[model samples]
Target: MSRIRPQVRISRRLSTTAGVAVTTATLLTAALSPAAHADTRPSRATAIENAAAALLAHAASLGLTSAENTSVRDVIVDKDGTQHVRYDRTYHQLPVLGGDFVVHLAPDGAYRSADRSTRAPISLASIVPKIASPEAAGLAVNALRAANLGTVLKQVKAKPELIVDALHGTPRLAWRTNAVGLDSLGNPVARTVLTDARTGAQIDAWDSIETAAGDGKSLYSGTVPLQTTPSGSSYQLKDPTRGNTYTGDAQGQTDACILSICISRAPAVLFTDADNHWGSGTTADRASAAVDAQYGTDETWDYYKNVQGRNGIGGDGKGSYNRVHYGSNYNNAFWDDSCFCMTYGDGDGTTFGPLVALDVAGHEMTHGVTSKTAALTYSGESGGLNEATSDVLGTLVEWYANNPSDPGDYLIGEKIVKPGFGHTALRYMDKPSKDGSSADYWSSSVGNLDVHYSSGVANHFAYLLAEGSGPKTINGVSYDSPTYNGSTITGIGRDKLGKIWYRALTVYMTSSTNYKGARTATLNAAKDLYGAGSTEYDTVAAAWSAVNVN
Candidate 1:
């Protein structure tokens, strides 16, 4: 859960709590559970929340503590018919900070507990997709970011109305991406739009896809191969002097986050070319994109290869490159295919390094990795995961560095930025609610929360699973996690969790992977690496439930 910053699910018990603490493990123990076929059914967010609340209520009742004895919080399930549960805490004596109980459920519905907590091992990779799946792959595309919509709209230029339609509908991926032109620097420019599944109405807009090839170029040009060689968990950046030292795939100029991609087309940073993303604010300074770019790549690389055993963006032992100093005062960094690199900016001085933080570099790079491997489409449920992946991996990279110059740790983006805007890294995994907004898990009304902050649940869960529940100090940083049922989790090394997650992501997860899918995948992953009925498996399941993934 250590992203550019940290995300954790902590079940902290107050110095006092005499009531409402009855809970038990709800892990389904089936010999060979029913067949799980992936379902292509469109994911309904409303369903996730409803089911979660009902489950919460169910968990609340499981507590052994009597009502007058203590406060209770539990994952309630909506009996109307949704198999979901969530994390909730209640206070019996709010004024005194006493009598508070909480409950958490795992998305897999396999394991759970309340109050009295003990860390048990559980399998990882062997965890399978949720039973909701109707097929082997399940529902895939969930593109719901402003950037992603922009990318889609850019691709379907001929149908502008689809963009509006999507805003009013369930939103589907029924658009085609088309290249348009090239920026002054020669980066490809394109446009896209979404259409109604039935009437083909202008339901949405997808951002464009930028590339080194001309706008007319195909995703895989006949000349340039689509990485003929399989990528993996080890790579060296094309040598610094390889003269591969160019940027702007179109013009081959050296730049980072140059806004050189099809954002004008598919504006989402993930889909756009790195060059096109170079916003002018950060690039305007003499901005040495050099150190920042190299720093990002190296930092990310060490984390994956050394800590997580992941290759490059492709997870096939490939190495991604870095581009620096883009545009006129560019203020941010991003990852893209054309450059396959990370960019940076010179902050307006509110913060020192415009590059944000070393952890951010890993964050953006991991996004590329996530895009290629899990391909968790950027939207709704998966989108939150996608963002969380970036944060988690970014933090892992910092920890991997263990550099005196940087001293990588859980404090994401701290070295590079001190934002006057708000928290340095946009969100906090340790306590999603710390910012005072964002929900930690599925709320029947989760759509109301910002994807960036709303992801706190998953983020916190990951952190707690990695470091254990409760307050502790690491590298001088004091941390505490709020858990369901007011219990505690055990700490597993960040490096180990990173590997399990990486494997689950690149090897097991599919485009349609969701909260439920993530649970199963991680559980399965634990099995693949640690063995069935191992301590790892139990903890993995317990951690998920701790966040109401149940």
Candidate 2:
């Protein structure tokens, strides 16, 4: 793309750490053990009912009751049968901001504790806003302008919602305004501005759009099947069979942003060709990149649905479109949650060519999955995990595709690496430290490093968990993974690794989960998928320990 979307784009940074040595004997001794019994439990419905009843019994003390019009938002069950039920409340039929809480339940369905986002109850004098809705919208736009986001073109929809502000200060009524448009790069833009209805003071503002910028191929992925729609005269790039996922051409303009708010993007005109067959497998042809972008989108959609049981990126079975040939020789790709689309860049042709490589495609799209679920904050250890999640799934997608042209391996961005980049890939899971910056083992300061580098800890852990620590070859790729405690970990196979990680991501992880939280999350995931004392569970524990995540 002409301008890279800055918010969620993955940045590759290189830094080094002195390897903290540990003895093999110590590692084996430090390995994690099963924490609970694996006996069969009650049916899901029964367990949920018991947990709900337990929470209701303590509702009064927790500032919740039937009169508050609170309803369960989600119910999460951990491996130890602990239930975490998140509830959303409404005050006088109006949604209450900060009126959400998670009720923790013991394995026996007893109330253990409750974590409330808001400290105080949803007690408000009036739910009505003193400021008019139009005036609230104006305040939001002004706030956006104050934040250097002056253009507010696309005005998707603006509405006022009531929320309580007890967490930050004294409880009071507020209005939350959601505005979406386009940015300067034609990528989607959005902001949720919270204003004090009593005084019209801007309380908070956050970008609604989660972005990470993308693709082509014929240049990357080899000849592949594409789903197309016939538009009377010619076929369009839209895929009707796959939730109508389509590919549009930016035509290198980068100024098609509309709605005044949308970023200045190349016009997203649907890609159409006279012949059904597209692309020449070279950057000289525009369809080449479009072909790669479209193919990648299809593969990613299928991978999530068929492998992970996810219907779509948002798990809603809705097809998202792709923008190809974005900007002139842009060197990055990103995913925009606001637009629900993936954008790809044509590589500068030096260090990179077209970025629509198979794994990269999967890597970018998994960001959306991360956004929809867990919603990991893009900083610190959580950010590292976020990037690692994408890398892990992206590698799996490549493996799932089983493309001969680009075989699946622990190497990322392998196909796009420049000759003089020194390393063959962007990051190496087998030996992440080989990237010159990634951490092979976790440390207290790991979170302080660049997320891309911090992800090395998890990447190395995944490699050991899946293929073990040793020198080996798979699909012509060789990997030798090292551990923190200098221990040898046996392989659990990639399929099991994928299952455990996916489960943890969708079920146990939260926005603020850290490295320690990740260990618990995966352990719980493994226990839930396998038995508590099962080999998978032990392997997960062992893997985390090997990476110094314990």
Candidate 3:
């Protein structure tokens, strides 16, 4: 149960928005009116092919290619004016998790999951639901195909067993948390800006969440916006400051309910169309894939917000974009240079699966946060600090989300581990020394292991700086973490530790910072948060000495 080979550990793929628009009522059908057909003469099947071909042409310009295209299977124009063209294979691609998807169109104007082998129809009425009345406004699979979309995977592999009906009509928008409500096309938004509906006087403050996404791009979501004048229309826009799940369990993470995120710079807000086409998978799972890639992104934003008084990813009071499920069972998760988005993989029941753990999610996304903030390189000691910064805050988020419903602890990757490999998670903070692979002290060669494992010393130091060197039980287990010089170091709590560490990461540490820099940073951060000669300051100094970090 204690030690296993690194091979089992090596098989895992590791981690890691913006905007607004207020407008008048606009129809969001993407513009659709069935092509005029003189009922007198029945339209030929070639007509269907031509239309589908045209749809693909539109898709080509959207960057869809190779495995992300679609194919038109059949077409049907029922007795009414509805056009339900059956797509034999509707391919999908998740930006984060490289997976695949195949869709089907129901005779009843609904889209369903396609069983490429049996051609069995899986109900789309469940996953995406049937909100678009005419269904004519839906994406033109054939046209998108012509543009850049591709076909179904030749080789099929097992995928997450998704029951579409589970996500049917209800659409699961903000299903768990509040009253403001989520919009129809999967955007969770609420109107907050309110004017007198009279004169545009200086009678009140600007209402509405500070940042908003999707609605700016949902050209098809037709809803009349609120007018500012008192005699005009008064719309209550969500206050980005008010709606965030910041203080408690949410700690910047989304609940099934809080649609209060201030996404300012997200690129794929409205016109974003994900393609879940790894090798063989479904789009839903691909959607799920994004969960791991950006889960901590929220944590990172929150960490900076609460700890550093920053906003969004850039700390510029803006937001960032994230795309998941880029391709099938992707073996890894990475942040790209161009988009600053996270990518992930679906595990093979061993090592690789959902990367939704609070810390893991934060750790990966923090890579970018670190890049933009500290610009820490991925080698030498600064790199170690960069990785540790994520782990430290990731754990902070876990604690911030601490609830009796789902109690929090100082273990990483615990949720994703299974029975084999001792079911042990990644690094342990309570007693970093307990994990044989991690270091209790920064060594000359401490940067030898994977960043995940090598950052243990810093993780250990964080624990000591906050909680102090002690023997205590966290969760169900108990352990005593050691300090290098064997000095009796006084510890604080995770929150205090977080404030100090965060200040250090953002204000002091540079790209080439090493262990010595970490010590100076902690001392400086403590001095900044508390007084220079305060207990917090001295404790930070003692903690560094105790851990031999200096």
Candidate 4:
């Protein structure tokens, strides 16, 4: 989840790409249990109309102009009668980049609050571009080459779209062009170059492709039930039961990426077999890794669906795909948003075994969830928070699975690490500094460190929040968490902690949320769930302070 600003190293891939993919057999074709609600609304259209009218009447409250047209994207009314209405905006008939906003209304149909991607208004100077589209495409291509990226320029498509500048300086008109190609590493790359329409000068550019996804006898998680779809004489890996979660074999190649691999040469073919029984527990069989990836994905899906009330990784009832045995002896795994899929590596046995372990899958899948929700940028303190979120959720998934062979613990990647390393795990939450690189306390220069290491502060904060600041044993593992301050604090329990963190991540936290902002977000979440000034809120504040985030 965290990477240094520029370089794309292998170690960075491991921390940033771990996640789960899920699958099901014919038996799991049942409908998902609908969330229980108390009150009923008149109709979806009526609710949308009511919310839209309210938003239009109070446009200034949301920093919107009267000229902007707002269209309802989706509306969700909670069991408590709270309505969350999401809308897309267009300025003077042109799409606005950061104009999306969500309006929350209380049961009384009164405005509660709103969440906007950008606080700046959308009124720009003009829609006409000073530079032509062809020249803009050339500018984007030149900018890509100027970055010294060890990749070739391929099909570059430049289209002019009117956008308001909110991230950098004052609001201004810009031409946004997206150039799609492949990096030197064979990874699919897309760069959105924002050029000043008045001057044709490049404002900014970022790598469009970012890695971010899950079922079944799973090779590592033991024999498990899977939902499958019948297709003539054979069955497909598709799981009608769990949002059509499917599996595909990369066969150690990138171009064959299915639902979840980025920059694949061709579409991934579903792994079909005469019998639905897939994989023996060894690498000699190709399906074994798919079994592991799918099983882990299923468990993670169930954990979020049953425990946290999330439908899928994106909170929508759509399943992501998984690819196994990707690249020959690849030493790492990753989740790419471009393909909406999860990819696995069969590690060189001497340094690491197969990377499809339960926690590893959970870690990577949670990355997708993070991108959809808080969307913490993969740099600075926010990046650290992104990685920490995966670690926390991944650990929870492991505990939820309750697998006998891989019992739950705060330790990560313990089973996958080779014996030659003498390392018990990749990182420890209770005492993260044990890794020698991770930081256990927040500091002024904390964001300067690698995102994975900087995440230790949040990881340490989570440990103290759930288990307190003292020596303890859990699930056969011993841990003694230290605090930046010498204050003794009591834990609020993992269940409550998980609820608070999930709420903060989904509702309160933003893309650029830092350590201090996180403390406030969790505190706000705790207050919302357990009442203001309650013991839970106090504990959240105390835990954050213990991590030197105050």
Candidate 5:
């Protein structure tokens, strides 16, 4: 999202902490450093230090006690000197898992408010663990094995880290372990398991690899221009203009990783051609699929940079590489934060093609964006919102590209799913229930559904916010959106909708934000974009209500 400053007023009493002073001079120095020169801005290091200092100065006001410490995770500064500082906390030197939060500051460095992952206070009867680390590792490994039942795992390994488990319930000592191994297909699979330190019981376990299912044709956008780097004599499939983001052939291999360490990573063999002209429009040529992958990356990069003012997926001006032709007839694509890259699969011809469609690329890349920003927990309502965020922005990326061959539409993965798949599209944002599994509106039982299907509520809301309810046709695609309440909403346009949602995701939403929290975040975002009671703000409320979010 763009670093747009909002004139928001948050009223809260600041807790007093003696011997700590955040002077105006310090704030001015940090804020003005970015504009020290007309052509230059503050370095990343400088910004981070400044943000850390700012947060530490007001630790007490943020509900941080003397036993707690804060470390800066991210810093976002607006042109008007407004600041959003993200932080990860620790208690008595132990890492706090759900202790992350964001502190908002006005232009003058005045405290606005703080959004925390949890409101529960951090305390422990004892820091000592009844369960040993090695035992925890074994439990984690067993959990991983159970997840991959009926498969023989190779090179299995597990590493455990002691942490305070604030995310799952009351804060308590816990062991967070990452288990990695090669699956039956020789594909690398990893899962993170959380086990109670005192009790041997498993608290939670999730696959570390984030994934979305779909496929697409080779050169799905037809012939498109590419930006490649000249390596020695031939041009390599690397775009230096976009942080040297290169597309590589995985040679049907997957990377085995544990946390940030990869034991055996598939070679990202760079694609080099004698001439820069990369691909023909057929799957017979490997470069054809590579072309679609690279083009999708380019368009996604441009969409965020040009449309949202985000420098990159991480908002750090660094490009992420893409790996295509990833396994034999693999029917899925995924984003690996551990590898910081995108991996696409070659789908079975009958059901899917190459899985490198523009929208698919956009969708997968957006997962990285969400990780860098809100880092929404990938379960329940937050997980649904996470998926919806990708779908919403991915669709916007398609429209931003405006490629005639693959025109913008709300039908996701349409180019990917063939007739054999028995579905017109992976999802229908206009009416998510059309997919036969997705929810049409929010209900108490919505959270019980899989994240992909639960995402329908927000997806439906986004469609109504952009296109409104009732029948409509745009770019030759017909849509009939219904509302929970029989109220018609007049769209304020996709551009405004994007801005509002982006602001909510980056500025207002927290890691644990649910459907209700999402509604609040979007409303706050709308109020920030337009004035409160403005048509845009009212429309945002109306749209959420239409999805039964109210």
Candidate 6:
């Protein structure tokens, strides 16, 4: 099985300035100051807004001109009061692609350092498009159609927005168009096309759907407990505890779309049961699959909330829904941002069973998490990172669950892949190359591989980071992870790995980050969480080197 998603571009530059060290006397003096007593600390939002305003006021130092403006994308205030502010830039009112950057400030609001997506100056010749929006949109639709060659597309629609393409070489006026329609399977297919506004040539294009190769009987996890909502005499497969997240029976229906319009969408008919007991742990019962889907969703939600401190997938305490039995023998699962939901395929039965495994559920939901945070473009190295992020965290989610039936392992989708698939699992984090297509070490050509296979680099790094090199048995599963440079590495434990990677994804990484960027992000994250030169920080560096990232 394979997966596809959208893409972005990134190049980073670091600018640092020394901050004055705060002394105990300075702190005591400030604590006793009348202004300190009179001024209550501002709200987090206010402080971040104030910081953005201050940073904008000194735009020249940040490599920005008066013609550029910024809006906040994300903000992180550390335990030590250090602030990291991420912003997106607009040049002359046109969005600047790859013009995003993060500014780090000291506790005293002094400039410390910055990570810019691109160091190139943004100065487009003109915002006006000679090719026009309609023409650009037509080209985008054609590109989309060309990409999906044998499939008949319906409800085809293309929407083009003009932007400054700072992502590619030399910032220039371009049209970023999203062309969407339904594939032959009735699955919504979309491509985001970037076209040179002046020349009317296609610059770049990528699939917008975030997908995973594989889902349930109560399938993989055996029989699991579920939280349901009472609706009259029957119970709805909705968990009130986890933000009303419910599992709906798609009833073998698929989505219908034309261009941007979704004419006949699959209805998430609430799965209702008279007795509260859901699923017989077999596909013979419809509630059986629903049970697995609901359980997987619950475990994923709990893993993020309990281990990662995220309130929900978006960290906003909002729940995302799940749709099971999506399409007849659909064979794939996806996390759709537009619907804020997870949809699973029933599989062709020979290649796969139900697409609702716990790790698969976690993997799909983590896509939502990535979209909310780094928004790593789903192509090239960044796309690989995006997929690897999900794999890493999804593995952690399985470990966090500690379910007896599906004990955690470094393998992904082990429960979903059928015997006819000719593989034990969809992916192996400890030795990704075992699957035949994945790359175990980083190389220039690694980015040229599919995002799933390229993700092997990070997955290998994560396995080495958590379990180290050489053979070992974790939870009865054996692994012998090797390093790229043949250097021995000692395990740092998965708990620390989770903390470091989560922080990197949420605080340090940008949308366009690549393999090298990921190394930097994780190193910075380790330094933030475990201190510079700490064992954990050193291990993070060693792990990346083991994966040939350095």
Better of 2 and 5 by TM-score: 5
Per-model TM-score, in order, reads 0.55, 0.71, 0.48, 0.79, 0.89, 0.89
372-488 in candidate 4: lDDT tens per residue? 656676666877898888888888899888988788889877867787646678789998889788999999999887677888999999989988999988888999998888989
Candidate 2, residues 400-480, lDDT tens digits: the string is: 888888888998888876775566788899889897888989999998886778888988888889999988888887777
Cα lDDT over the full model 6: 0.79
RMSD list, candidates in order: 18.6, 11.8, 26.4, 8.7, 6.4, 7.1
Off by over 4 Å in 1: 1-173, 176-193, 201-289, 315-318
Q: Which candidate has the highest lDDT of all?
A: 6
Instruction: Point out the higher-scoring one by lDDT: 1 or 2.
Output: 2
Q: Give the Cα error of residue 43 in candidate 2, in Å.
A: 14
lDDT string, candidate 3, 275-322, tens digits: 211111222423233332333455456566665454544444444444
lDDT comparing candidate 5 with the true structure: 0.78
Candidate 1 worst ten-residue window by lDDT: 212-221
lDDT of each: 0.45, 0.70, 0.42, 0.69, 0.78, 0.79
Which regions of candidate 5 fall more than 4 Å away from where they truly are? 1-58, 149-152, 214-218
Candidate order by decreasing lDDT: 6, 5, 2, 4, 1, 3
Decreasing TM-score order of the candidates = 6, 5, 4, 2, 1, 3
* TM-score between model 5 and native: 0.89
For candidate 4, what is the lDDT?
A: 0.69
